[model samples]
Target: MKLHHLEALVSVADAGSIRAAARLLQLSQAAVTKALRELESEQQLALLVRTAGGVSFTDVGYRLLQHARLVVGQIERASEELAKLRGDQAGKLAIAVTPLVMVTFLPETVSLFRKQMPAIQLEIFEGLTAVALPRLREGALDFGILALAAALTDQEFDIEPLFAYESRAMARRGHPSAGKHSLHDLLDQNWAVNFTPASYESLMQDLFWQHGAKIAPARLHSTHSYSLMLELVRYSDMLTVAPEPLLLTESMRNWAQPLRLDEQFGTRRVSVISLRNTMRSQAAMCFVDCLRKVIRTRSRSASEANRMLFDRLELLF
Candidate 1:
């Protein structure tokens, strides 16, 4: 019936026991029990059944717990917004990003955003869109940056296409295949492929197959960590795929080289994805602006080699 009642019920469900919930809520055991009882009385439903180990929610109780979580989360977000409106500049922004973005532009964007909104807390989750979308829909993420599987419709999300970059094959600086320009020359080498959604992976696979080459089962390794993939390429004979800009970093270039593969892997679209119904807070909007500026600057200053590469691949847009 009351906020505290909902809070107590949700906490108990999360903590799995009244005593644990009391500790988590920083309230007395009796207080937590009383709140749960009062909530049940008001709802006219038996919410929880106690046991020696902990507790279990009744079927109805479990259903109410889901609603309770949303209510508590909304209240917390509302409080954060109110604080921001008071000129506190203090709020939380959670962003989900693909690993490519994490390595390429996110750090610079975060740095610039933090300088402008120092009081705002930023949480970044790195994953493919498939992993991030459900969380974004559930209100866990404020926004995301990744390659979309399909064009966005206004019914589900507000999608803004940012930029597309060519995917490049990378190898250790002294790799034997460094001078290999043809896909056939590199087909025999081991590979550490970035794990994207299946749709994107299929696209990549098609690129190779279309070029008369196939990534061998014994030679392929898949991962979501850009750093690990880079390391594998650096320390071993493994090859990996990444955006040209990511491979061109000075630190990365010191250990690895973007191979001049004669095959085109087609540009991947990176976009900003946010829930359609959610209103963007001032802080969230500011961060999005920061991201846009960073991308624009990088796109404008792309190297001549990258420019030519993009041009050749028809990815200049």
Candidate 2:
């Protein structure tokens, strides 16, 4: 099928009606309908059925829709790639960042990315693994910085690992469990955990198992909202497992204390992921580069401080 045919099909699938798709493409509804007809005629299969609201994809149509999405997405990326090669500072990059990243290095990444690609537009939003994966598949998002239980395996996406995340099981200062020096001692407390469909709850279970316990907290609550989870820990007896970066935020640094457990969590990671076999435009790479630079800068600062302390101890000896 022609580019316009695939475009029309993709638009209709997204916009739900020929009329609305026309609005999106800035074309007449009749032109869109004509394109769809030409496509179906060539395929020799009925792709869509009319509905009172608009149209619905036929069984085969549903399968074809994915192909259309990929083709359409590739074309857009091709255009961006060509523009980038020509040294043109245009086109857009859309990315999703998890809440942990937002509170930590996002501002630095944004500033650094803009210094490299000043004219490129950026669209970023808060999303977790569940919201990000499907959008990545649909070509709705260009890049994602997502939290994962570990490095993702061979999926439809290419993963560039950022770092292994360190987590702390924490509670409000003066919490009874805060002073408990072993996971076994805190086992009876209620806990609020951050989890998504991608299964970060397993991280909590792993926390106990790593500490030589076989079970999770006595009472477990799962929440997707970081603020909600933190507030629960602050106001109530609920403790929460949070990324170490989250604990460094101004509000949490003052209000929360890490549970004095003998056991630490194993590896969870935050990484940059994008659709595989697709062109990564210059702007997208620049953003990833900036993210790395910020992480390095932060790491170096911490290392230098440790070095200074070590040097002081050398003089003492």
Judging by lDDT against the true structure, name the best candidate.
Answer: 2
Find the number of clashing residue pairs for candidate 1: 0
TM-score of each: 0.67, 0.73
lDDT of 1: 0.75
Q: List ranges where model 1 is wrong by over 4 Å.
A: 1-75, 86-88, 98-108, 127-131, 148-155, 179-188, 196-218, 296-317
Candidate 2 whole-model C-alpha lDDT, 0 to 1: 0.77
The alpha-carbon lDDT assigned to residue 36 of candidate 2 equals 95
RMSD of each: 5.8, 5.9
Model 1 pairs whose backbones collide: none
| CA RMSD (A), model 2 | 5.9
Q: List the residue pairs that clash in candidate 2.
A: none
How many times do residue backbones clash in model 2?
A: 0
Computed on alpha carbons, the lDDT of every model, listed in order, comes to: 0.75, 0.77
Give the per-residue lDDT digits (tens) of candidate 1, residues 1-317. 89999899878976879999999999999999999999899889999998887889999998888677656766777788888778676688888887756766778999999999998888888756556776666566778887753333546788877767677787888889889988888768888765445445564555576677876666777665666776788887898776666655554856777888778776667778887766767778888889877766665676884464334222222
